[model samples]
Target: MSLLDLSWRNMKRNIRLYTIYFISMLVGVIIYFTFAGLMFNEDVVTAIQNKENYKTIIFVASMIVFLFIVFFILYANSFFMKQRKKEFGMYILYGMKERQVASMVFYETLFLSAISVTSGIFIGGLLSKFFGKILMNLMHYKDDISFAFPLEAVVSTILLFALLIGIITFQSYWNVRRMQIVELFHAKEKMDKPLQFSMPLAILSVLLIASSYYTITMGGTSNLWKDYFKESLLATTVALIVGTYLFFRQFSGWILQRMSRSKNYLLGNKMLWISSLRFSIRGNTVNFTFNSLISAVIIFGVGFIAVDYAVKADVVRKEYPNDMIFSSQDNRTQQQIEQILNDSHPILAHETITGIQTEKIANRKPFLDHPDYYTEEFTIFPEAQLNAIVDLRGVGEKVDVKGDEAIVLTRGIDQPKTYLSTLPTMTVFGDHTFQVVERIRFPLLSIPTDASGGSEHQPSVLVISDEAFEQLKGTRPITSYEVYKIEDPKTSNNVSRQIYDIVKRTEGSYYSAFIDMYSIDIESSSLILFSVAFFAAIALFALASVIYFKQLREATEEREHYAILRKMGVHDNVMKQIIWKQLLFVFLPPLLLGLLHSWFLLYYTVILIIKDLPALTTIIFSVMGLYVLTYMIFYVSSTSIYFKIINEKNTR
Candidate 1:
């Protein structure tokens, strides 16, 4: 058989052991393909036709994620290469030249990588349409988008993977070239105990971990992400990674010694469990470090991902009841404008009158917390604009302050003259003394995320009752809200004409109409693009962690332990239970903590977007489910490898 056929046969012969590596690499390719396609999808391009920044974010995020996947595929392929050392040695012993062996390895990898990557990308594209629809639906976008299997995206992702595979293949070739017959012939020799790390390293690790986590939770909210940001994270991560590995390196002895002395908590299977864990920790310090890093990466990556989604999905729309909204200035009378608007669209809701509130917000340092809160200069609403707004949104319902008393509600403000002033300022008009009430929630289109991703703000009408409307006389004339609700939403195309008519009839100026679909498209796309990038980083860390541990387990000693345990009459069921327990120790804590972290991040991000918390908590469950489904697939594949080791032990 040709080298291709021989290598293919060898790969199939050990398919069980190689499947995890293959599947992970394939999934990475798929994710990259899907994201690349989505980023440049025709619909997205058409919708954001002239928006350069949006495309830039899409490309930058895609490139970062794609490069990450490349490194991951290469890193992951290393372990598979290590595992095949014995087969390579035998190929050499059977008089196969190293050059031919290199050719064989390259062909097999190229064939396997191509198959997996192509299949993965194909599946990813097939499903991306559904994903796009669901996302658009969530934002209540009525626009129909076309999602073609983006050939360019597929080609780009494939070329990247192919290049990565070539690098890994070359690395294998170098390994074969360097291997002497002795090392290859004795590939199954036992491993020796590794030198322990110094005591200071453990303490350092503890300090590093505590410090890094503190920085993440505290610093992640910063908007100055362009500056000292990346450096700080890099320094912290390096400290954390080195320290953790060192701590785990010597951790086994310390743990075992303590547990052996404990009279209560150390007594039964607990000690054994601790012993096993400590053994794993000591023997697999690198693995433990890998796991911990993965967990932290998951927390950080998902935190950012969820937060980005929440910002666009829930926070940004908090104050805008529609695509565009502004309260009018109080001095102007908007009665004629409201009437004109009412006369035009029979189905449009009337202009809502809201009680304007005024407050002299003190200090104001914390109000606009983020540096990007607002621009330096913007116009405050004039009295005429306020009156026009009142005409549009005024609750003509009068408050009977009491007999012979009238109170006027006014838009109140004491806005500071800085770029940071976020809350609006209002001026009370007329002779009415309007007392300040607590700052109320602003209006925004509150489309809940339904199965189809509906994006529409709710209509709420709240104003002072008739008893509260009268206290003192005001100069501003009462402008009754005039709105018409039509049964069909689609027929509201003429609402702009109605507004213009109102403007002409009332001689009204500064009227605005809320537009749809475009805004929703922008917001949702920005969020999903961020989400895919953040999640890709997390997935990389998780895959690295799982595979690292598996590599550690495959090192000669751990497999021998399985052999010894079987020979000692341990029940197969007990052995299975132990493996199960081991898997949980590795998997559960991070998963739980990562999920809790996701909820917290989601909560904060949502506040940034919509200025309200999600009423339903099921999203937490959904996020958790998604994580488990994806991460656990790799975990399960790794554990099944243990069973194969146990079988090898028994046969011996």
Candidate 2:
């Protein structure tokens, strides 16, 4: 028979083994094709107004997808070559030249790659429009787009995969030509030396991982170690990576050796499983470590993306309780603001909030007890006006300041006692003294404007009785706040844009934290959320396939060991249990370690995103659930495949 016919027959005989690799390759290509199609979709570009940056983001993402697929294909191909070394060795023993063996492998690679890539692109074409719609929804684009075939995307995917296939085929040819006759037959028997754990090295690994985690989660609310942030983070990252490698290299084998010493635990069936795990884990340490690290990143990255969106949404809602807050200290008046709002659009519900604006005394001691408090003057509001606009009881007790007493309205800053303890009586503008009654919270106005038109170092506000406000003969500037709620909240973003444009035309430097926060929310939520999620999905699938294929490859090597156990009166059910236990040892370590990494990573994300532990915990759980679900799929499949391979010998 010709080499082509021989290669085809060999592939058919080992179709099951080839199917696993084919499916993995196809899934990766399909994902890549779908992402590329979305990137090149004309309708999607038009829906988002054809932003060059969006296109750049999608293009970069597609490149990453391509690189990931290439890595997967090459790695799987290398392992498949190793698995079939015995078969190839026999062809050599029968006088088949190395050149013919190379040709056979070249043909196999060509056939498999063609089938997977073509089928993958075909499937991707069918799903491209749906993928585009999902991207639109994720980016919050309101415009509806019609479906169109992405011819450019199809051509690009085909060319890229064709090139990838050529590279793999060339690589196969080179690898086969390098293999000697006897070495090929014994390639599968060449296991790495038994792993030995050094106590000092193991201790160093623990220290490094711990130090890295500490460095990552350092500088709590106040950013206490801000100066050390950058250098420490870089060092910690390097340490964590090296430490993780050392941990897997020595930790698993060391622990298994210790466990084997326990007579009761390591007796009989347990001994066989432990022996299998110990012998196999040394060779797989690097892979398991690498996979664990990637899995951790995927879990944390995807979870943090979702949590970031939720946190930004919450911040936007809290900061902008009203749709717009138009404040100006210049010749701009309440009437001008109202006219601008009315002339451009129909008048929606609006309210004008007025407050007394006074500069704080530069260095005045209000109360002698608190040294950390930097006392400052604040805009004072009368009880009637304060109650009209703000929730009094929600912050502090509603004050009935009978005489000269006044209450302070404040935000939830860290050191409340340092600020509140000295608030019973305070001096304003160097001469005016007022009795403090209570401290109310500022819900929407936590951050106060500074001289530079940003948040001040300290945030403070005062609330006094109406009688006190009217009786004040102090000469201080008074400011008015005009808050507006749009008729439709859905159009709030567009209205904000319009208002910003108007401000720009008038050369106004009106600063609204709410507007700035809202803009950031919209931009980041759209840009980062979907991209990270897509990569996370790809990482997850890659991880599952790698672990499944690795376990499946070992099935042949392990079959003989199981055969010996069967002759010694071990039932198939017991052997199955042993396989499950052995696989669990291989699988659970990486997953659990990855989860440990994810926990610390997610905690650090919470520090930036929400700062509320319980809320972030909920987000973490939801994200972890997605990862666990994906993992279980491969775990079940890998275990079943392992069982089937081992049992094949028993059918004889």
Q: Number of clashing residue pairs in every model?
A: 55, 2
Clashing pairs in 2: 360-377, 406-437
Q: Model 1, residue 192: displacement in angstroms?
A: 5.5
lDDT of 1 by residue, 449-478 (tens): 221223432322123334434331133344
Q: For residues 555-647, could you state the per-residue lDDT of candidate 2 as single tens digits?
A: 878788788888988997898788888888778888888988888987775646566645777778888888888887778778889989987
Q: What value does the lDDT take at residue 215 in candidate 2?
A: 73
Please give the distance, in angstroms, between residue 242's alpha carbon in candidate 1 and its true position after superposition: 7.4
Work out candidate 1's RMSD over C-alphas. 8.9
